[model samples]
Target chain A: MRWVDLVKVEARIAPLKAARPGDGRGSQSARVSVTETGGQLSRSSTGGVARLVAGGVWTIATADRLEPSIDEAVNTLRGTVEIDLGSIVQIDTAGAWLITRLERELSARGVSVSLVSASENARRLLEALAPAERDVPPPPETIGVVQELLEAVGRTMVRSWEDLKSGLGILGGVVRGLSIGLRHPRRMRFTSIIFHMEQTGLRAVPIIALMSFLIGAIIAQQSAYQLAYFGADIFVVDLVGILVLRELGVLLTAIMVAGRSGSAFTAEIGSMKMREEIDALSVIGLDPLHVLILPRLIALILVLPLLTFIADVCALAGGGMMSWAYLGLPPDTFITRLRDAVALNTLFVGLIKAPFMALIIGIVAAAEGLRVAGSAESLGTHTTSSVVKSIFMVIVVDGIFAMYFAAVRY
Target chain B: MRGAGKNPEEVIRGRGITVGFGDRLILDNLDIDVYRGEILGVVGASGTGKSVLLRTILGLQPMRAGEVEVLGVPYSDAAPAARSAVDRRLGVLFQHGALFSSLTVLQNVQVPMREHLRLSPRLMDELARLKIELVGLAPDAADKMPSELSGGMIKRAGLARALALDPDIVFLDEPTSGLDPIGAADFDALIETLRDTLGLTVFMVTHDLDSLYTACDRIAVLGDRRVLIEGTMGDMMAFNHPWVQQYFRGTRARRLGA
Candidate 1:
């Protein structure tokens, strides 16, 4: 046997050795040689029949030593070969596979092979191997990188188009739901809308207040340091007032709500979709769009503008406090300068975008949640993508609003 | 058949094994033995520490008292080399298959072989294929992920992994739980065949009455924090425990008898 084959045989024997209860069988196994020193293979011609004899133990422990000889012996045979296993004492899966493989090789060469005097265990194992050996799979084909890249691009385009079509469908559902609610206001699930308002809007007060406050203070402090060189510290109040009222307050607050409420919406609805609770709702004749999505959308639209107003006041107060602390400007004069530098149009500009931003976040999150599949992994993926896509679109809409308000001179 | 008392070498022996979670004692000074080359079916009602017994014997649960011996070697707190030697000879199939969802069937079968053997890649492929075929899975199913398979195929794939190293004793936790009647019967047949061909000592924890009736060589009933009785199906049929009477001759058991 080859040196590597010897090492492999010894490795398999180690587990069998440790598995046996006592050490007495260890010595018995050591004396059982796996090589051709005791094993024998004989071929004889009798009455125009080719008979091949297999003798001694045929097991995994002896497989490596016997494999090459078995392969060589089977190749030298012709049609109508009889494999006589009357003298073979033991056989394992590896030994059985080799015998079956030799039979397969013979069949490919148009030499019919037959077995005689085989053990029952060998016959049963060989029967199990027959179907697998017959139905061999072809090797996989290697593709060029350009082909793979083109395939991926095609798949992505198809997915994006499907997403767009589904978005339009959701929009139609929302419009239809609103029209139905208008026709019968009392049947419009007012309680659910109120409940969601408290969850998404009223519950978000502290976080939105604190985040907008810190942002307002940071802007005032930085702009004050720069304006101090120009000896125009009082203008910090006007700068803070215009920036927070028109852009920063609503933009930052919408982003916060998208992360907080959008993710919550996706997780809650995605888990429902996963459990088929949405299916149950629809089966009971309650439109999922009306029962699940509509209330959430209306709640967000109402709550976001209210939240923007809170953020606006808290930010102005923070700016006034920072101006008082660092620039030594009193609150009375800060409001006085603020009134001169800004107008109601600036404040209304930020409030105007809040509802639309809320709509985008609410719709995107709800849509992503409904897209969840059967598995837990899919639910997680959709939830993460919902938060990411909502945040991205919120910023994108904010940028578009900035340009639109600039163009129309709002 | 070997008698109970005469040089009966138990491949697994548990003595006075007491395991408790908090104040609730699960197994109280339980003693059990699994003889070599026999399929011992452990049965019990739900929440009756049947799985706890299997886990404790496998050294997964820490016992407050008593010692456990597997393959004639004490496993708990033993020398690392001695414990590892015993581990190489034992295989466990947990409930639900617990297959790695990310790995394909072929890769899952290869994991144990890769850790245990130094065979060539070609030999490993051949061996894993044989194992897959042995477990009655189609050859093409080897490349499929666990999520892609049906419940029955998952259990078969798990059985293939358990047989990867040709372990001396295989522990199966509720192996037939999620399968339909036909599927569970086929699985029981597969277990019986494996034991016959491979000389395996199987310790199966099951609630399937059909398995206890047809597949097992002997049955052990666990209740009241210990093994209540262990013997042949005839012995179980004649045993006098009230829980055993209710369990072995219940409406479901009578229907299974039909």
Candidate 2:
């Protein structure tokens, strides 16, 4: 046996040893030799007739050792071969499958194989496994590496096209729902909107506030250290003020919300789709976009800006505290510097991106959820991609806004 | 009910089983026995602990108080080796066809063989294919994941995995619950054929009256927290209990001319 086989034997015996520590039969070396000697096959050839004698346990546990000899016998033996099973003490499906496969292989090679002195139980097992002789189709072939790469690239391109179409479709449906709701305010699901606001906005306050605060303080300390080299440590207040209000606050908040509420939306709607609840609603003449997707979208759009405003305030407060402690800049001086560095448009630039980010997250999540098939695994996959696609789109939209602001010199 | 004494032919013997959740007792001092080479059907009303009994016997559920001996070994309290020895001889098919979602039907059937025995992958594949065919699944189903299968195919694949080890006793929970009438009958016939060829002792929990009539050799009715009656289909018809009377001779049973 190879080293790997020895390791496998040790792993197999370890559990048996732990299970029965003091039992005499549980001796590891003793059991290995016993298994080897339990099953025996001897072939004697006279002229063109080969008599193959088999004995002892022929179950699955001993099949690994017995299979090679059987294969060799099938390859070398020609003419008529008689397999004697008279001394076989035990057998199972695995053992029977082996014997049946051997007989079939020999017969296919035009060697007449006959079974003699077999017990009734062995015959029954062999008959039960005889249907396995029917040809089974081979597993699907895999493409070569270059072709596989091309296939993947094509699949991803088609998938992204489908995604873009669905995103536009959902946006149009939401717009239609908004128009109908505007015409008849009473038709809007205000209670559902409120419930979702509490779930996605109100419950997320503490974590979002804490995250913004930590990020603000880290930026303050790092900038102060760099500015202290030039004896301009007070400029850390301006860096913290502009960066937090213009970019980090809303971007971080959108990323967090994408991970949190965006994935939740996909999971909830995907499970409903999996169970055919969406179909049930359609059959009942209720639009899923109007009832399900509309409330979530509106709640996200309304709450994201409010959350962004709160995140900005918390981040500014954290920067103020960090400037005071780390740079010895008093709170009053830090406030004056922040006021001088940022104007009204600075905060609005960040808040303006909030609703657009929310829209992207909602549309992607709802689209993925609606695409779910009837499996828990599919629901999980869609939920994962909802978060991933929304986060990626959020960053991409932020980059577009950045480039637009820089070009127009805002 | 039959006496609770041990019998040599009994493959599974449970005595004085008591199982419960919280303050509610589900099974109270229940005694059950499964004989070798017999298709024993266990039936009861919904939430009457029929599945709970099956789980308890399989050692998946913890019984409040009981002792179960499988293959003449005390399964519940045996040494780990002895318990695993008993476990290797038993197979269980859960309701909902709980094949591992990530594995193909072939790999699902190979799981037990991989864990317990040292066999080549080629032989394992052939044996798994044999089992899949034995359970009446199409040959091509070997490569399909559990998600790709329909309701009936899932049950058949689950049965194939259960029979992977060539177990002596097979436990089935609601084996034919979701299939159409023709599909359910086909599954029942498949179970009967497997039991005949493999000499498998089937312990099936079912609600399908046709299956109980056509496939089972003996029927056990669980009611009032214990087996109310156990015998042939004729014995179930002659039993005096109201629930048993309505169940075996109900409108659906009447459609089958019971």
Candidate 3:
């Protein structure tokens, strides 16, 4: 063999050597030999074939030369040893037909022939070497109970504290990134802030307005039924105003933006991370945290307040319309009551929460995006996580505000 | 394809470059040089510090024990502004296209110019379109998202983006590994044309032998923790290095040569 060929063979057979039995069964193992001769085999070459049988099983490596003698040998021995025809470097179709015939003859007598593992041309020739009714051993069946059990436990473990740890790591990255932005306000341009607000906040107006209007109308209509029973339907005006301003207005708007732009932030940045465009920015001596994260955070911060304020206006308008229809209360009276019932603190609480919620959404989304490591699936998962986490954080923050406000009121 | 012979002044000179991930050294005392206006192809077995070298040169990776000079500026000598100034002279095409999905192909190509050059939007668009055309993409492709393109098309689009600023140097990591023979040959021809026309220096990391022979002015065979041999393909074949011989005489190499 050539030196390169010897290296290739040794590299391939290294694992097989480790599997060998150490009790000297190595002597019984099959051996491969290649010999060249000018003589064609009919009967005189039987001794040459004998010289090749140096071990338990012998394989003759030849190229279009020893077909006749090899054919005769196949006919002579049916079950004593495995015959490997797969390694033939070359063959004619007629030779392949003869090999197939020998394969069928031997298989009928309960012997197996070594096939495949040859060069493409030889493998094509050996394709029909298997008999039509030959019985091949079935593949070992897999015990899926262990796999299923392991998968179940694996999934359970993945969803537990480890997942939370990753989530917190992402959260920490967001906070760290945002803190840097705050320290270097120049990192976030005022123009990009305006642009982002126009895109994410101003563009989101119609949806938020429509949603708040429907919610207010629904609340007014529901309260009208209960108030009418007590001959006090006018109270629906007070109910709708207080409920929307105190809770639904800020909460629902944040949730909507969380689902909408928050997830967008996550997906946009996540895809950027996946594609290494973020790395490209760093390589170009631009801080990706500043260029990407800052503008987004600023935009979200500026937009959330305006969106919340619009949602508040629309909800009150819808409630005013419904109150006029059912409660016979004048628009001016309802407006006055809304102005009085929603204390300055309540309005301040909502407005104050807006920037914090924006920061939360922006950080959560960008953090999730940054955490994306692999395929598109990770992006989807992170987007979902960003929305869920931002909304949850928003609600929790709002709840804290509510408690503080209640304590001050009482 | 050989440039007017000069002293081969090094455009990038890396000395004893060492990179580590935690405790494991990915690259150990690796020294390399990329010459001006030369196409250097780096080949190695998998995970043999090929990409680490590329990153270290770009300053994206911090070398634990080494110094590197790119275009006469030490990689870490500059702060942000100076670093960006040095960076403006270079471009990178990663394995994936890494295009900004929200931006159009034209916009993706225009990013470097937008950041560094004070060019007009109309002018940037014109230049970006020119680059896109130069990379053999259709004019209509200039507006499409990255998702709309095929794998080979994405690589070409990435090439267009890398050429956006008309940088003097370019780095392509595995530019043709996934392409069919015809596609790969087309890519090689494109690189050759760019090298001749633009006088750009290229550092290409690849195992594709056809690319090494057809495009690289010199090949750097990376092994044994550093470059084992750096020479022309003919020189590489003549050399008695076992890895080089094995690589040049491989079955796939023979088929590629044929």
Candidate 4:
């Protein structure tokens, strides 16, 4: 059956080739044919006169194949040229532009060009396109790889400077908004803050708890496996407790919140900016920082520490379960070890980083959002940057906290 | 509805085109035919489904009953290659100028040409520039993004893209809605000139009475989920329907004398 289909396909294609005899591969002078009514061009020179006959459906579809022939005619044809348009069945702007271009190029070369026997429709199009025969400006030049790289580096530096300025501006605006809310407690948008809190915090509990629990179990199993070699299997509980309380709990929770709530903040505010709603708010004498960013920022700052506490507890529970199941240490023994290993300060250090992380996330997201231009693409770009910049800042702030605690010997 | 005599070739034929969103019927059993080489202006009161009918004929919206034949092909039911062949021969300019926001006007015009034809980049540039100039946009406006263009310039840029392929038919949705009077008049003149020079069949959904009076060869008024009247300006004036009477003989339309 396959062999029969192949034979039939060949039988179909054989006549197409025969019917289109002008079809040739990469011939500069050869006249190419497309469809049955595709554009056809032929050149003949006799006694210092070149007579070119153009025929068939001369539109944009055939312009690609017809263009090279016209160029070849322009470059090679010398002296007077007569272009016969009698046989041309149809001509659109593209075709007319080609003929007009050929005429202009020949005239520029001191060769008298005459368009003869053009049909009424063809004549109208040619006359219409006569004024449109101006030189097209060349496309923008592409720079070399080295120059592009250097330019990108320079752009990144400038962009970073702008980001810093905008970040500080947002922080100041947030402070001003907070002061306004403090002075007029009635102006505080408590409903909006609660809405954002519900959206970003309450809805996020299950996913955040599940993620932290899995991390805690994995860490316990790995640590117990390593500690057992030295007959120090009981030390895994101390490791899990201190790590979850001081670093992993807050860091993982902040990163997750940045991915979740931070991107949402950027997208929401960015779409408002894109639609000129931000400008509308400003014109209405309402500071967008107060009306829009304040509620979201307050909610994030209030929620991050609470979420971190939840994450810590879930992680500790996961570690206790893992120890009991894998290392044969019971939950009470694990709890006793955790209490002995980690102090109140250890938990405080982690909880203290949460608000600062929240502030960074909120500021970056809001700043990026407000920077969105009048395009959906710009909104997407800013939303993505908001997530990336907040995550990077979260890690950097965590590292700084770690260094500060180490330096003070806290 | 068929014409009285002298049968003209129908470039677009919509038969019993029933379109609705959920249970709300916008166009019910509507039939419309647009002849070749004619500017057919479709007008109606707001929410009468003028744009819906246009979308139906273009196959952008699904019709619950009947079919549309464009350029003698029922493209919705046609094979993929056949559909694209018909699609290449048709051009559409949406109400909002619908230029790709990320691309410049020049690149937007080149998009259709690039997809269908295998022209050289230089030829594409020149053709695109010619189109831009033909639509009366400033040469420098070619490099500006859609966001940077004014409302009138965006419409012109969109028209340039629509005419990019030298399509057999051009469908324009509210082409002059956002333009100033002078710009709207210029656009109407441009559309008329394009039709004359390129022999293009234009299906224009417009509210501009000036365009209907001066540029459109025939007008189709949509009403009550179907076409109420489809005829010349003279026939429109004589039609006794209340909406038709108000539309053609309204105060705004009365400024242009019969």
Q: Against the true structure, whose DockQ is highest?
A: 4
Instruction: Give the TM-score of each candidate.
Output: 0.78, 0.91, 0.45, 0.92
Model 1 misses residue A9 by how many Å? Answer: 6.5
Candidates ranked, most accurate by DockQ first: 4, 2, 1, 3
iRMS per model in Å: 7.8, 10.4, 29.4, 13.4
lDDT of 3 at B27: 81
By DockQ, the better pick of 1 and 3 is 1
Q: For each candidate, C-alpha RMSD in Å?
A: 6.2, 5.5, 22.3, 6.0
Error of 2 at A274 (Å): 2.7
Which residues of candidate 3, in runs, are more than 4 Å off? A1-185, B1-258
True contacts kept of each: 0.05, 0.22, 0.00, 0.33
Q: Residue pairs in steric clash, candidate 1?
A: none
Instruction: Flag regions of model 2 displaced more than 4 Å.
Output: A1-37, B1-8, B78-82
lDDT of 1 at A327: 90
TM-scores of chain A in all candidate models:
0.74, 0.88, 0.63, 0.90
Docking verdict class for candidate 4: acceptable
lDDT of 2 at A237: 82
- Model 1 chain A poorest ten-residue lDDT run: A18-27
User: If the candidates were sorted by their TM-score against the true structure, best first, what order would they fall in?
Assistant: 4, 2, 1, 3
Clash-forming residue pairs, model 3: none
